[model samples]
Target: MAGMCCGFVGEGDSSANSRPSRRRNLDMLPFKYIADMTVAPSGTSRKRRQADLSGKKDFESCEGSNGDRGNEKSKKNKNESSKVSENKPSTEGNLEDGEFPKFGVTSVCGRRRDMEDSVSVQTSFYEELFHFFGVFDGHGCSHVATMCKERLHEILKEQINESQENFEWNSTMQQGFARMDDEVQRWNSSSQTVTCRCELQTPHCDAVGSTAVVAVVTPDKIIVSNCGDSRAVLCRNGVAIPLSFDHKPDRPDELIRVEAAGGRVIYWDGPRVLGVLAMSRAIGDNYLKPYVISEPEVTVTERRVEDECLILASDGLWDVVSNETACGVVRMCLKAHMMTSPAESPANNEVTTDGSDQACSDASILLTKLALARHSSDNVSVVVIDLRKDQRPTSNSNYNLIN
Candidate 1:
């Protein structure tokens, strides 16, 4: 089986479940995100704003864009109002929503021999102005991550709709993840959706698993749910805020839970659950059972005026770049292009589209390039959403590049 463009799996290699651990000294975010490692930044769609950051040159400057920090302060002072409606994002698969989702994304199979990551984006998802974004990193095979890209959002939405209270994000997120894990098992038990290397072999394809980080953006709030190592970050007023924490096996709380469940954290390169998976939680990995569960940690934050953008990625980019550095780069891009591309107006009701804003596109491109520049050895995926409303910063950012 060939490795995919977004997710990579060697032709016959099945060791991805035990992907090597890169850090034991992760830097901390304001939300206490354990950064001793790089989580692959994930959100969806390859067709929109795709660019190869592997090249040595810096990105071509956007129209009216300038470099240098001095101009940012003066430029940021001017804000605008618009009548355009919120638009739907591009799809990670073969999806077409007619135009840009107003978010920017980028993913690449850098240094890694194959690709196995998946991203998904849907705007105005549950109601008017509510949106969904997610990134998945598959281990053991591409199917698990791909499966997540195809259905996790629907599962989450289903849970939300089925709820009696409807908007209790925390409980609904937990149930959504539980249902997703069940679906993976049920689907794997009977058939192999893709011509995956796993060949649907173990019971319910128990050998496979995936790391997921998902976010729901509403007119007034940002709700994030995470399982495994993928991450979601909020760039608020120049500070990098982590919405979800990583579930590395070595993390104190995670290690304690694993031990209580009678599972061992083995040091295979770094730390692994029973010397198998490096993360203590994920959507699948049924063989790990009680130890490696599908329950996601959820965080909800109110939207603020100073919010710059939201970043969601897999460990691939985080492994090599720090949270502050990533935020700094994106902020620079947005500021440089402030005059040429002002933020989108918050008044649009229905959706319309074309492509991502230039600054966001530039930011996503530069981040991936920076990751490769730092020699990241895995798939790199990123999604940047301009949350600055009434003063939109190019409106959005989205790009994807894979093997």
Candidate 2:
């Protein structure tokens, strides 16, 4: 028998760069003992084997040696199942990753009464640039804030989708606030009321309400909706652009609503719309429901590229810091510069060292510190959106967060 031989010589070989001409060579043998062979350079042997055996596998040996193979296959399957179970997303994952069941929120009760405040961020299309941040500050009880936290986004989406015309910014905002209030009342009416026996405690079932400030960021515009004392502000080029006005009971329009609702705006020390309530338009406070149903005065402004950031915070933050000071603090936080935490006591001029300047950092923590520093007596909550980095306009059709 004649054996086929293959070899390769490196460096000075002429065949290194040349393509070998195809030819057939054979070793003659008896028909019953016929065999076929092909020769290739040592470097090409592994490649040729890979190309020829792309799909075929050695099942015959495994079938014959079924004893060990069964145990091995069972172990592999069990390992894979465990891996899948391990990979299941946790509750915290849902919040942080913005998955189907969205997540990523942080709240502290602070040194106050029941933390009746709630905040959340929702991104439906997974476009990092499209985001919604909200702050709900509840009074009397936490129902209004809890409800808003759960359903505000759904209500807004429903209103937007039902409208045939392109959403006029103001009208859309008005409807969103109205819808939110309606939903909150509907929920309260359906549940069994709880009553507080203590005189100092707010009537548990009687009138619990909250102020809502929602900031919706789209590809072309940023829409802000507000009711009651809660406020939303956009920091543009280091200036505060007030997105919503505080609806004080003293305001002429608010006073008109208060009186019309059979509630007199009594001013003993100052203007009192509905006795002690400072704001005429707010969600919940069943006593104020009649006046609350009135549409919130809506204000819409086209967003400019220079609008660097937005802060949707409760009165707790505003009561301590002026709009100008708030803007300055946010700007410094965005630039990685130092700012005193709101938690520090201003009376003593004490400074806290936990303030963060990272763009992707949560603003609530810093806002809490600021509130503490300003000595805000009320519970403080803040929702900060870094517009420049969080919701940037994109040329691509897909949504993505700005880096």
Candidate 3:
């Protein structure tokens, strides 16, 4: 595996389970497992494995357009007497109907490596204006990531629906991760698991796992849930505030938990749990069960008028780009579009064919390209969400905290 170093630049850069029952609490997302400290046999995915798992479940699985954000806001602000139909795109508008919470997404296979990464964008799962975005970085194989790309949101939607009666965002998110991990584990052990495409000739199998970061944008709040290192950052008033914490083995809390679980963080190339997986939590990788967990840390932040956008990405982009730099780049891109086409009206699903508007539409693609240029070693995946509406900031001087 290529070494991925962590660095922060100054303003510039640079689930569930299947099988047996165990006492698990959805309230606090607690994880308990029977202790077995035996080392995994040579050639297995995990160098260590816990025996006869109990008191918790095994890892497993479950389950975008741009102008989407701005377009919706325009819809709400449209003249009351206007004849524009709510169901269709306007002939005179630059955006398609219902495209608000605009999305820009892109992904690329690593240099000479299998593209195990997967990204997803979902709009209007619960409400016409709601949105969900995620980036998954798979290790070992793409199967687990693919499974999550397909079903995580669906399960999450179901959980959210159930929570509507009571409305506990954090608990709902935590439950969703636990349930999804179970599904992934069951699939990994099932006969349906297939061998994913590999270009680097590295190891690939169902024993693989993926790092996931997800953001759900509602009218009032942005709820983010993450496991492993993929991240979600909210660009509010030109500053990037992290919404979810990365679950890395070397992190103080993570290191303490690993040791308590009888696992050691070894620095072979970088800090890794049991000298293997670099992440402290993830979906799948059954061999790492009871050591590396599946519980997700979730955050619920209320939306604000000062919020500019939300960025969801794999480590491919974050490893090389600083939060401020990313926020600045995206702000500039959106600002350019606003200046180039100040009179552009929101149309129904209208596609940007060329120029700066087109560039804004490809925000995710542009971010991925930038990461690649910086020599990111892992497969790259990015999803840029335009959370602002009305007009672009006139200058950097306009940025200020919402409070």
For all predicted structures, in order, the TM-scores are 0.70, 0.60, 0.71
Task: Count clashing residue pairs in model 1.
Answer: 42
lDDT of 1 by residue, 126-202 (tens): 53245678888877776888788778778876775566433467888888888889998888777545476663366
Predicted structure 3: lDDT: 0.62
Clash counts for the predictions, in order: 42, 18, 34
lDDT of 3 by residue, 1-403 (tens): 2557221111011111321221122223321111111223567322111111011221211001232233433243335413334322122233333445655655665331345667666655444445677778877667778778778889987886565345577788889988888898776566663655522232334457888898877666788989999999888987899998889889999999999999898886678888778788988777777888888899888777788878888887888888878777777766656554334633223433310124344566567667767867566666777776556445545443222
RMSD of each: 12.6, 31.7, 16.5
What does the lDDT come to for candidate 2? 0.49
> Comparing candidate 1 with candidate 2, which one achieves the higher lDDT?
1
With candidate 2 superimposed using the best TM-score fit, by how many Å does residue 130's alpha carbon deviate from the native? 3.7
**Could you give the candidate ranking by TM-score, starting with the highest?**
3, 1, 2
State, as a TM-score between 0 and 1, how close model 1 is to the true structure. Answer: 0.70
Each model's lDDT: 0.62, 0.49, 0.62
- Sliding window of 10 residues with minimal summed lDDT for model 3: 7-16
lDDT of 3 at 6: 23
